[model samples]
Target chain A: MTQPIRVLLAKVGLDGHDRGVKVVARTLRDAGMDVIYSGLHRTPEEVVTAAIQEDVDVLGVSLLSGVQLTVFPKIFQLLASKGADDMIVVAGGVMPDEDVVEIKRMGVREVLLQDTPPDEIVQTLTRLVAERGER
Target chain B: MSRYVPSSELVERAARGEVPAIGRLISRAEAGMPEARGALATIYRRAGRAHVIGLTGVPGSGKSTLVAALTARLRTQGLKVGIVAVDPSSPYSGGAILGDRIRMSDLVNDPGVYIRSMATRGAMGGLARATLDAVDILDLGGFDTIIIETVGVGQDEVEIAKASHTTVVVSAPGLGDEIQAIKAGMLEIADIHVVSKCDRSDANRTLVDIKQMLTLGAATSAKPEWQTPVVGVSSYTGEGFDALTRAIDRHRDVAFGTASGSRRQLAIARFRLEKTAENLLIERFAKAAVTRAPALAERLRRRDADPYSLANELLAASFERGSAHERDHHRPPHFAEDHW
Candidate 1:
């Protein structure tokens, strides 16, 4: 049975550096996730709205700038209001570990610090998809 | 023997293993059908079973060979892969030649792989919603990983992530100002960066430039989960496919989680809806104006009224209908076609 994981990846802030995000987007696309990239300078609200509307299984936010707190929460609160408490939110960028923890508590499940391998990202998603695929 | 059929019928028949019908439906979409929306919706409910990966880079990035290599490796793992290879739309005929898929002939006929070639129909970026829709259908049809390979990420390749989960930006050894020419929109969307055709002389320099760019792009306080991993891969000699696939698996499996999944879906859904509405409204608005064109134009030519006023008069109700915002939000097909 073929199921394409729907993923919403967005750049949630003013930073427009997406070289990394573009690579990850293609990687996920090849792996078979229907990925939607919310274009540059997307507000947290726009990113979250796109995630909810796309019905994505993975919401991967790419931030080159250090504003995950403001951006991630806007997305989180937006998802919460839409009754999507179980969605997966992943953040990737030059994030420090402490900031990553704070985002996680606010509803993000995993925070990928820089240099994480692509296979690891795929593996995490595969396991989660399999787990959810069971549900 | 394949021919256009009602989208619903073709979609239903295609669902039952009728490959031809599926081809026809995809062909119609390739031909640019407004009704592909319904077919896409049917496909969406049954989607989410495939891993969607996107490949993009400038010309000669060897995206095709890279994809071929990756597909070969994925096949080794006993996985069924669907490849959506996009070629640039013919400027004259407004159709795609799909020359990229020609490189993956080894697996094209394999029952384990399904390869579909699409022409980039001015979707502004090699990635288009229709391409994504096709991916959605294939996903529902049960492919393990759906690969959308763009020949190169030219100015138009910006559209990739609108429909995929992971976006991979590919670069190779030989560009002069690729670093400088990179735009703000294109600079910020990568999840993984690959140096395709790395056997070239200056591949290392390109890699270094990519790293510098990634670093320059990052900002304060945003310690993202992972740094953009730049890997060197040569699609021609079967080098790095394993590591590439490994990178892909990690990005998907470890870097993603459950909190934002639902929200991402919403973003795509809304974008699709808005796009559909915008298209329909434009089509309808254009049609309405065309029907009344003769009378309005005659009046204007006679100096009886200004063209803008006439246009406003003719489109007054449509304007009052507030269809602009709604049109920006959603749409259904109208009776008239833009038939010449």
Candidate 2:
């Protein structure tokens, strides 16, 4: 049987704005991916632990609180420390282009901005998993 | 990352309490990957030491929050806890949003607690098919208590009772009096009933209603070895958790310590055997249908054959091919004979 691509969407730090994240969650779910939402105000440690435990193919951190630069690095550090650096990490929500480039440099596989269309979001995630190939 | 690691090595790492190894094995098992079968059998043999608890209830009943609270309570006693929380998959997309971990954020960083969220993946009865397998993997990983928090369900999803040594059914206030009365199917299967959100005044009514129903059930039936207790708790205030844990512990004692406990075990084994066989047979049937059903469907559409006979033919062909395939592959040692 073909396993569904599992993605964990986490709202890290003090971000209470989850409307966009919930929309992305629905988009991912409707596009045939198992989405585990870690809810809001999750610590970087909590997110990485959840990502590893869920054995997700992707970890999508939605941050509208503008802590992407600070949080994504810490998340990647935790993931590396836990020997789960192989997991594909993605970032979403409001961020400037320079921070996006820096976040990508920090080892995030993709940085999805707030305005990325639903279909594009779905296609991008699906292609990322496909490019990574099967487990 | 796609490189194959032998299952033996994975199992060895899992036995040493490696979280990543256990998680990987569980993922393999959940996906129904054939390579994990021997490893799973080994894990199964090494399991049964952990106390398996099932917590299930209706939607909006606070099952997930209660699980977080209960896991916290269990952890205070220095017990290692493993949690399998299940959520439903959409019928259209075959995907799910497993939001149980949202309520369980505090437990995430604790090394003593391991939580895995599962999608129902088209399985019925409010549980994923691999839930018990995950439980076994966690059991072999040295968890002292394994808790399965099922997808929020209504009356008919009593499969948790068959899979667990202790089943706790959570009920919340304001769902209506008639709704509780109509849930006799669920009420009968509870080893312990919890009225969550007890900070609300209406929780007292729910508690009383459940207690009254249990008393009525006890009077009509032969006295059970364990009397089901209805305890009110509030995740917000943390009221009555100690009493709740005590009741759960008491129920576990009766389930494992008494002669009737052995009977319960036999029943659980029988249920598992039947359910596993049914799943295997369905899987085989689906596999066979992929290759053979189109022609059969054409014949049926043309009125050349009926469904029953064609279905029987399909089953026969599938099993015949299965046995031949089994003959070609080296068979693993039977569970009873394997000493490892």
Candidate 3:
């Protein structure tokens, strides 16, 4: 039998605001996926390490502290350096449209803004996981 | 035919202490994939070598931090550790956001430690059966110590006390009196009562309260063979770890040193057997009962028949059918097909 999708939800950088990530955690959980949430103030290295160690199918980083440009790429580089580039990485929390586009260009599977509904986040994650699993 | 059969390659890799292979095996177990049973069957022979320690307490009780600290300490002593953190699943989605991994990030890069998060997945016990299976896999994979940190819901959490050889129930300061740790019935199951975040001013009072409760409780009414130690620990500062480890070692020596230790082992074995049998029996019979006696449920719902007698009647019918099938070589297609 195929394993259920496992996603790691992390807050990267100085993002002490975690209310959004908590909601996403609950939403994904309600959607019947296994989610591992690494709490706030995590460096990119810490996030990548946890994602690989946990063997998660996807990594969703929430960054409300406005460092997505630097954090997301560093995370991608770390995932590459650790030979975990195959892990699907997504971004959420507060990011401007232009920065979201730039971060997406940096190998984020998807960028979910703060306005994205919880259900939509779940749907996006489900789709991303399924798409990745097929590969 | 076997429901699921683990690949020999995967089993071999896990047995050789390959991290990814062990992670895959644990994932299969958590998902209740049929082949997981076969994998566990293979691993079970090599398990029972590691000490299983269970940690439980209320939310925000510093369980994850303590686990990290303990893993660090154990590693310093040249012991390999495995951690299984059980998280509560959402009632609506049957999914869980397991956050325990976040606290132990420092150990993620260490080859001496392995951490996996598990969702309850609607299991009757506080922990999903998969959690136990994962622990066994970790044990067989060469972890000297396995810690099963549980999500601390009230009554359901009692199962952890039974599942582990040593149950450490953690509490912190400022939970208030009416909702104190004692009121949660945690004291009954605690082999070691850990007061975490000892840096708080109220920490001393919480320790005092725990000591007072232990003294007053029935667990200490008589001159007990071993006294339960309430140790204060601050996971942040790493204070009191020596005392905590000593307490754990002392308890382990006395518990495993005596005849009662063996008795406790027997009890755990019995629990495992019963739980597995009960789950299998329910899977086989519950569906069969619904199909054969659809009206039985309706009648009971209408209060025409009481649950006690109805349960007895169902059990009798189920047993008779089961025995007849076994003895006479008769089979019910639907009965055998419908299993969770």
Candidate 4:
């Protein structure tokens, strides 16, 4: 039986605005992955646990509260400690170009800036997640 | 490691009001087993005690903030509250997206309030089946009111409203257009309509739009005689929590009624048993289907047999299992009846 690719979309830290996140959620749902959104204000641990239980292939976090430095590192470390390093972690939100580049070095697959179109993020993620399945 | 499964043990402890043990017990019970079933039965009796209030709105409608305020007001009234915050399940990651901590900051330190965020788990209509189960767990844990905060808009809100005594639909000003779009649609599910972020100038227009929709809908749709009350409040400024709480309180008692709430208890009991039975049957069906379908499908695909004959064989097999279940399940009762 063929299962739809599963993506865990989360909003982390003090940023509680979920308009962009929900729109992305609708977009992803239309794109045909079994999208599970953690909704708003998720911490790294909860996101990791949900990924494990939901058996997701990619963990995507969209943060707009300017707390990327605190959240991204924590998610990466938690995933590693939980032996979830194999699961791809993607970050998006209001990060500077330099911060996005720096996050990529720290084990995040992509840094999605707010300037990035919703479809662009979806397409990038769809390609990355689809590749993970091929392996 | 002995595969140290404490779930069974934890479930037993939780039923007895050992507060610390409830979470682990709920996890194990959700996993489902004989022990979990027994634990659920004992704990489920305490369920119908709470009034179920459903809070739902659009994305960015500030639902979480509103609920946090509702929790505060309920606490002041010396009421124990159970909140089941429904989160969307992601397609790629297949997990809960909204984190538990940040959404419900106020309740983190409060022992009186228990907040559990649930992913729809790929289920349509927003709230998951497990959400009902978790509500019972908290009800048994002893809450006076249980609030279900839904993840998104549309049909899911209506479904949850059917389950709750009072369904509070939250929305804001700028969302006036979208709220109007769904007015004759899903927003009609509300027992009370709340317009949050009332401080904004547009809030009044949004409230007026909702009222007009309500008025138009009331003519055609014979809703309960009481108009679905509309209130404007800003969760940020701590406004209107009191009225929302009062309305929630009054609506619950009247809807649940004079049997001293025996009917709601029966409803929840029915909900629990129905769910438990469905869960068991589904598990059995899946296991059997997984093991046997490939060969059946392969033969069908090869055109060695027609679909009609294939279905007949499958039906016969299912009938055999049905008879076996009836025989085993009814034998003890049959013998007792015969003896009588």
Candidate 5:
């Protein structure tokens, strides 16, 4: 039997705008993924720790506080240190196109802009996890 | 990803309290991987040590908060705790967002405490079967106590009764009808009834109502049972936790002192055995039924055969095969095909 894809959604940094992440979490859950929402006001360390402990297939960080430059890099580094770098990392929330490219360059797997539809986010996550192969 | 580890090695690592190994083993159990059976067989005897506690209540009754507080209190005694927070899966998607541990962020960093959130995944029981499996793994991993928390509603939440030695029913101020729901059936199964949010004015009323119901239940009951204690606690104000813990300890003492604790153990053993056999029989029957369902359906649609008789026949055939597999060496060839 195949396990359902497990995804962790966290609000990293001081950005309290969690409505978007919560909606995405609900959408992904409705798409047949076991989602673990880490809740709001989570630091990079806390998010990475939870992602590793939960052993999720994907770690999604939704940050609107313009701290992705610092938070995403630290998260990626921590994942590598914790031997979970193989897990897919996706970022969402308000972002400039250049920042999205930069974050992706910093090892963030996918960046869904604020304008992306919830269904699209779900589809993208499904496709990314599928591409990463199975357990 | 740790599936490559042999079952024996996984069990060995889990016995050492390796968190990653335990997580991997539980994932295998949840996925129903073939290796899980072998792993469980190796670890099952190492279980039965952990105190299994079941917490259930209506939504927003602060069951999660109470669980966190109780866990923290237990940890202060230098005991390792494991929590299985069972949440509901979406009926449409068969998926869930397990957010119960969000209230216990402080315990996240505690190595001695392990919290795992479980989605019911359409399990008929409020507590998922996988939750029990995980609890076994945690027990084998040497946790001193394990807590299984579920959002209790309607009749299904009674399933929690089988998962723990002591079942704590959490109710709080407000939700008068929900409290009534608890009184309808849960009051009977509860070892300890907790009225959380004790700081609220309605707390006293809720306490009085629960005590009244418990007293009423005791009066009408036929069997001798442990008297259920109702404890009022406010996790927010950190009040009544000491009393709550003392009540839990007293209940444990009474249960262990009498035959009720052993009865709970027997019930759990019977439940696990029956559940496994039930799963196996259902799988075999469904596979056999598929080949004959179309004709059965046609007969039913045409009113040539009533559903009750057809269902009985299906059940009879399944049971006959189930019994024959244990007793007889030579089996008939294609039993369903030959008969149908």
Candidate 6:
């Protein structure tokens, strides 16, 4: 039997706004993927540690606290240090277009904007994991 | 990601408490990959040194919060703790939202604590098929205490009793009538009972109700060696946790020290053996049925055969094919080869 795609949805930094992340979590679950939510205000280190421990197919970081530029890079560094850089990383929540480009440059495979529909979020995550050939 | 790593190397790293290695081994076990069988066998052999505790309760009973509090308490004693938290999978999507870690976020940064969240993935009895394997992995990783937290379960999910050395059942105030515990069959399996949300005034009713039920049970049953204690704890104020821990420690002593302890061990072994065999049989049957089921369904639709006879025919054919495949491979069944 094929294993379901496992995703870790983390709210890194001091982001107390979790409504968006919760919606995305439900969206992913409805689309047949296991979503592990690492509640609000997690540091980059804590998030990466959980993702590694979970051995999830994807690590999706949700930030509404405007720390994406600083947080995503540290997460990638931690993942690399732990020999888990092969795992796909994705970012969601509010961000400027230019910041999204920079975040993608930092090795985040996908940048899901606030306007990205629920269907697209699911499809994008599914396609990303499929491309990684991990599931 | 599929690149092969020698199980021996992974086992060595895991034995030394390497976090990433432990995580990888757990993933392999959860996926039921054949390559992980050898590593799991090694893990199982190294396990049993750690105390296994199972916590079960209905939804919203503060189980996850209690686990966090309990882990912190155990850590204060310098004990290394490992937690396996199970969450239910959605029946429609076969997906799950494993939010147990939300309550456990504080414990993540501590090196002495390791928490893994599991999706039940359609397994009944309030646990994932690989839950015990993950527990063994943690035990092999040199943890002092391993806690298995089941999904907020309802009646008849007493499988936790067979898997844990000590089973703690949590009941909260205002969920329903006080007799919900007896109705859920939790009274029989609980080694220690906990009334969470004790800060609430109505919590007294639940506590009183459970105490009354225990009294009734004790009167009817013969004198027992170990008495189950009811603990009222408020995860918010941290009240009653010390008492809870004391009860757990005392029970562990009884479980490992007394003659009844040996009997409990035998029961645990029997349960594991039966569960492993059942899982293997279902898996092999599914594989064998894939090719034959379509034709059988067609026959049934055409009224050429009755359902009972066709089912028997399918079972016989599947078993025959299973044995033939075993002979051709010149190996024992996968479950026996891997687990035993």
- lDDT (Cα, 0-100) at A129 in candidate 6: 76
Q: Is candidate 4 or candidate 6 better by DockQ?
A: 6
lDDT of 2 by residue, B88-207 (tens): 999999989998988988898799999999999999997899999999999999999999999989778989999999999988899886556535878888888899999998888888
Instruction: Give the TM-score, chain B only, in order for the candidates.
Output: 0.80, 0.92, 0.84, 0.80, 0.87, 0.93
Cα TM-score per model: 0.60, 0.93, 0.80, 0.63, 0.88, 0.93
Query: How do the residues B291-330 of candidate 6 rate in per-residue lDDT, one tens digit apiece?
Result: 6788999999999999998888777655663454344432
Q: List where candidate 5 sits over 4 angstroms from the true fold.
A: B1-3, B219-225, B254-258, B285-295, B312-340
lDDT of 6 at B174: 88
Off by over 4 Å in 1: A1-135, B1-13, B16-18, B31-39, B183-185, B220-223, B254-256, B260-263, B289-340
Please give me the DockQ of candidate 2 compared with the native complex.
0.67
Candidate 4's docking class is: incorrect
Which is the winner by TM-score between candidate 2 and candidate 3? 2
Residue-wise lDDT of candidate 4 within B188-305, one digit each (tens)? 6777889999888888998898887777777776444456788888988877778887788777766677452455446645755665566554544444455556777888999989
Instruction: Please list all clashing residue pairs in model 5, or write none if there are none.
Output: none
C-alpha RMSD in Å of predicted model 1 compared with the true structure: 22.9
Encode model 1's per-residue lDDT on A1-135: one tens digit a residue: 134455667776689898998787667656655455555766666555445433456788887799988887777776767555567788887877888889989877777666989888877877766665421
Q: What share of the true interface contacts does candidate 4 keep?
A: 0.07
The 10 consecutive residues of candidate 4 chain B with the worst lDDT sum are B331-340
Residue A40 displacement (Å), model 5: 0.4
- Using lDDT as the measure, which candidate wins? 6
* lDDT per model vs. reference: 0.66, 0.86, 0.77, 0.67, 0.80, 0.87
Candidate 5: tens digits of C-alpha lDDT, residues B1-340: 3235676787888898876667767777777666567777767877878888899887888998899999999888888999888888888988898888798877877789888877787776678768888998999888988999985556456878776888898887987766686678777778888999999988999999999987876777633666678899999999989988888777666556668677878888998888766666665566547666677788899998899998877666654534434243323223353343
Tens digits of lDDT, candidate 3, A15-134 = 799898888877777778888888877888777767765768889998888888788778878877765667888888887889988987898888888888888887887888777653
TM-score of chain A of 4: 0.90
Q: After superposition, how far is residue B124 of candidate 3 from its true place, in Å?
A: 4.0
Residue range with the least summed lDDT across 10 consecutive positions in model 2 chain A: A77-86
By summed lDDT, which 10 consecutive residues of candidate 1 chain A come out lowest? A46-55
How well does candidate 6 score on lDDT at residue B284? 58
lDDT of 4 by residue, A1-135 (tens): 233455778877778888877777677666655566776666677766656444465788888877877887888787667545677788877777777877898888877776778788778887886666531
